[model samples]
Target: MNAVVFGAVLCAGVAAWVLCARDEAVRRARTLLVGPWGPPGPGCGVPGLRRLDVRVQALLEPFRVRFGWRLGRELLCLPAGLVLSVAAHSAVPAVLAAGAVPLVGRWLRGRESRALAEERALAAGALCSAVAGDLRAGLAPQGALAGALLREGWPGRPALADAALPLLAAARFGGDVPAALRTAARLDGAQGLAGVAACWQVAVDGGAGLADGLDRIAAALRSERDQREDLRTQLAAPRSTVLMLALLPLFGLVLGAGLGADPVGTLLRTPFGLGCLAAGGLLEWAGLAWTARIVRTAEAS
Candidate 1:
């Protein structure tokens, strides 16, 4: 088919994919995370096709995980390719570009997720350390917690700060130290902190010591922090390789389509060529799927 007709078909297919995804979301009572080439919303799309998306997502997840890339870019690229195909009037280049978009998107998403996760983990660790030290130095748990949170400039600090006001009220008006402690714990991003606060709250009600509990929490947080860093280090090399492998074929295919022999176009032009093209696409997808599986297994190991 000519580029215009091919692009229209491709666009129609994408539209169908999107519509199906939307229907599936509706049937399942789940929010649609995104609309075709649009922003995400919860429970906005197709339910039946979400399973298909999960399969696609699974294949893409490893690449996104390893490369620190955004899934959105890969997603956007498909529509971009369709639009580009229409504009380029060249089926080969458009098809090749369309195929490459997801890899790029996942890589971007992975990077963003990694950075955010690290920051939160580090903040949790630091908050743990600061609270332990401050409490030991005779500061009330609230004081220590507030100071730690302030120092970190946490992304969600405003919400935590707002939560703290009612907690402070609970301590002052109700004379309920336990309730206050629980509130403080909830405000902090540290899940372990909640446990510690609960313990202290109980201790306050019953007149017990919390020094030991605080020490244990600090130690645990520190250990967890170290483990996360070590895991990141271990995965670094393999992640790099996964990204390269996932991207290389896409780049090569596109380069071949655009610069080398126009096999994609030939495939479109002839029945035999079409069979070969379909086979090649299938093989390419299989290889990508295999590489993604390997990456995930390696990451898990």
Candidate 2:
């Protein structure tokens, strides 16, 4: 009798979920067709819910760009938490899992920032080489810069190309090329371009050989890139150690289960076990955060 009731309840829940999803889809379609100001839409009846939805979308925008399909994994946290809550008949694990979503998003953002920095470094080096080659070929500074912009397959090509627009404009109009370069350097993933701007200013103002200056800059950038690579290599062992330590608890849990200890049951059914789980999770999070901070500091230096 209990099994029949449970099955019926599960079927009912699934049916309701499907209905709700269908309704949401239809409402979204209507809103898209009619526009925001058309008629009242889903969540429009509740101002607070609407505001909260907006805030969540804003928060997720950056993560969506960085993680792509991986961002969907974060949304699974809520449902996974609910499943654990049902399986263990406890809410604690569910809440903890749900709370982890933000942390995961933050980690993804950090990875994106690091990648952008590396790309910018590469772009700076490529720009230096291109400019130096152009100068050697007897191209004017403006022509050299334009040619570099047209060159393909560089790490930060998109950003450099955008920066090149204002730069080319300045060069053509006999405006301040140095100032334009500095302005472009302020864009995201273009910080390294400031050095290029400085080199250009010195070459132009001090009557130095621009090609030689660019060559020197390219060499320095290449050396810096090598140093960064070495630093990452040195940090790999510590990162692996931290990851292995974090997984040790899972191994212990699995080992207990294999020994017929019903570790999962105990964790979900007993207050003491639940407390241990939460405490362990908190410690794991803290340790990961600390290790990450140390690594970031090393990278920044």
Query: Best TM-score goes to which candidate?
Result: 2
- lDDT assessment of candidate 1: 0.55
Give candidate 1 misplaced runs (Cα > 4 Å): 1-75, 87-118, 155-190, 205-212, 254-260, 267-301
Query: Residue-wise lDDT of candidate 1 within 138-203, one digit each (tens)?
Result: 987666666665565532332233334454455345555555545555433435546666666666
TM-score of each: 0.53, 0.71
Q: Each candidate's lDDT (Cα)?
A: 0.55, 0.66
The superposed Cα distance between candidate 2 and the true structure at residue 37, in angstroms, equals: 34
Residue 162 lDDT in candidate 2? 51
Per-residue lDDT value at 233 in model 1: 92
| Local accuracy of candidate 2 as per-residue lDDT tens digits, 1-301 | 2332343355345433322221222233344543443333223254554454445555665775687633422454566567656765668657876887776546545554555566667877888899899899999998787677557333123324456667767766777878988897886657767878888898888988888888887888899889998998999999999979987886786687667677776776788987887788789879988998999899889
Give candidate 2's TM-score.
0.71
Please give me the total number of clashing residue pairs in predicted model 2: 0
